[model samples]
Target chain A: MAQVLSLHAAERRQLAAWACDAYPHEACGLMLGVSEADGVRVLEVRRARNLNVERARDRYDIDPADYLAAEREATARGCELVGVWHTHPDHPARPSPTDLALAWPGWSYVIAAVTAAGMTELRAWRLNGGHQFDEESIEEADPS
Target chain B: MSHIVIRIPTPLRGHTAGADEVPVEARSVGEALARLGELHPGILERVLDGDGQPRQFVNIFLGSGNVRALDGMNTPVRDGDVLAIIPAVAGGGHESGGCKTESPSGTDYRA
Candidate 1:
């Protein structure tokens, strides 16, 4: 069985909020920091434009310059580009087949689902070496 | 007429008024989209190119595989077939920021 990495509650809530803001178009962003025995911690959240020319599709492209800058920033912070987060405006908060095919093995994929009432739900998954998905849970983090 | 299922994502739901999915029928993917445009005007421009091909950033998946690897917009769908429109993923840092951060375990590292 593959062990899915967990995320902090605050991090999940923040992501959900952002996803809602970018509703309709798939929201794109980066997850910062490393996963520890405790859970996945986020340092910051940055929003990027959905460069997919197909307005209603799942395909997205971050500007090359923006992509490079993000990579540099992540390295400087001593964190790996842990995962990519996006939203499924009116769909369930689950990874679609296209998502599975494009996902790189051994990385986390976060998805946020928004309902008509503007409610948000978030979930995380890990794509294993064999291209299988395992769901991870998000728990609230205690304020220190 | 052959019935085809077109899956709509949230961003484009405005064209379909928040409906998660719509059904249309045509001989080819392009034709199906044309029918969709008739039913929901202005949607074709968002999903197709001037020459009528799928926009570069848009990916049309037939079943579980991408149509680009198959036949582009010429990919045909049978009755009840589901076509998923997906956009390419964008935005991420390449170098400099490593996946290591301060944690209780001294330093957690990821890459």
Candidate 2:
């Protein structure tokens, strides 16, 4: 009985494209959306600048100013800064040990996997009550 | 005693009596954090570990730059400066999954 994350197909492509473009370095962004009992609806994707130059391949550190700005923007737009998304070059779209160690609860975490063959997978996860990651289903809506 | 503002991120707001920004007067970052802990109990423990060193996951920013990049806790503070405490964030796998739990470090996320 895993939770679900609903995003538009276009937004999915956007995330994949951004991750692909940031190959060899991780790209991160904020998700602006609404959360409900049934699922989370992603309304927009706010691209953030990754400042962690030393570990761009597997790690990302979003600028604090950018994070604040995104939060403010989401508040003004009647949405919440739901969660963060980062790319993992040559890695599977799963929560790494560092990711779990640094994770906060209550926000969505969408991870994009980009490989030499290009963007291969995009999945989402949530920290379950056991303080471990549990995969959630992604429901992509058709583009209008 | 120079008056400075400390911006508390949402996750740490509960420790500050639900205050987003706390105004305190101190000469250095260490003094400010100390005064902040005095004003609100159980806060310094969240920012600093038992050895009085800032936790590895916590990032403190003076204005737009990280204090760690400048001078660690010894970074001097002045009037009108803003210090922000932002802990490392992770663990959302779903866009709307209600994983409203504390971080793996066992830090309380009651809010």
Candidate 3:
């Protein structure tokens, strides 16, 4: 039983495009949304710069300032930063070992897999109460 | 007295009274941090070990360069310089419910 994440179809495409644009390197961003009884709903996406220039191939450091600013904006909009999204070039759409260690509970972690051929897949995961990442299902919703 | 801006990372901002960037007057990195700790109690314990040295997981940057590359704790400061206190972002090294925390060896600090 995986958690569900309701995201706008347009935003889903936008994130995949961003991942493609950063081909050969990892791209990351912040997701602002609300948590419902069943899962989470993504209302907005904020792109972030990957400051990990030295190891963009296997690691990403989303500018903390960007995260802080997005959180502030989400607060202003009556929503919360419910998750983070990042790309994994030529890697599987699964949370890596490092991802498991850095992830905090109760937030969705959406991973996009991009390669020279473009984005191959996108998936989401959430840290369970036991601190292990459980696969999440993405529900692309039509814009309201 | 130079007024240096200390940028607080998200994980440690709760100890800063919710301030992201705190400005303080001091002459060096060590002095500025000591002043910051005075202004916001309980922060020093998070970044410093019982020996008063920066913990292994904590990184202090003066401008774009790491303080370790310059002079460690004795790194000089100038007016308008930015001092960033960044916690090492790492995970999966051990099996724990969450990030690790260690209390100052002999201090009664809670953060």
Comparing only chain B with the true structure, the TM-scores of all models are: 0.76, 0.80, 0.81
Global lDDT scores for all candidate models: 0.61, 0.76, 0.76
Off by over 4 Å in 1: A1-10, A37-39, B1-111
The weakest ten consecutive residues by lDDT in model 1 chain B span B100-109
Which candidate, 1 or 2, would have the higher lDDT against the true structure?
2
Q: Give the TM-score of candidate 1.
A: 0.52
For residues B9-89, what per-residue lDDT tens digits would candidate 2 score against the true structure? 655666877566799999999899999999999888778877776776677888778887898788999999988887665
Residue lDDT tens for model 3, B1-111: 998899775556668875767999999899999999999999898777777778765677787777877998888899999888755442211122433443212222222
Cα distance off (Å), candidate 2, residue A132:
1.0
**Error in Å for residue B25 of model 1:** 57
Task: Please tell me the interface RMSD, in Å, for model 1.
Answer: 15.4
- Residue-level lDDT of model 1, residues A1-144, one tens digit each, is 434445566666677777667666667776766656544655655666666666533445554334334545675786655567777777777876556544544346777777556636777777654656678765555555
Over the full model, what C-alpha lDDT does candidate 1 score relative to the true structure?
0.61
Q: Return the DockQ of model 1.
A: 0.05
True contacts kept of 1: 0.09
lDDT string for model 2 (A47-135, tens) is 88877776566668777778877766775787666678888788889987667756765667899888867888999887776667788
Clashing pairs in 3: none
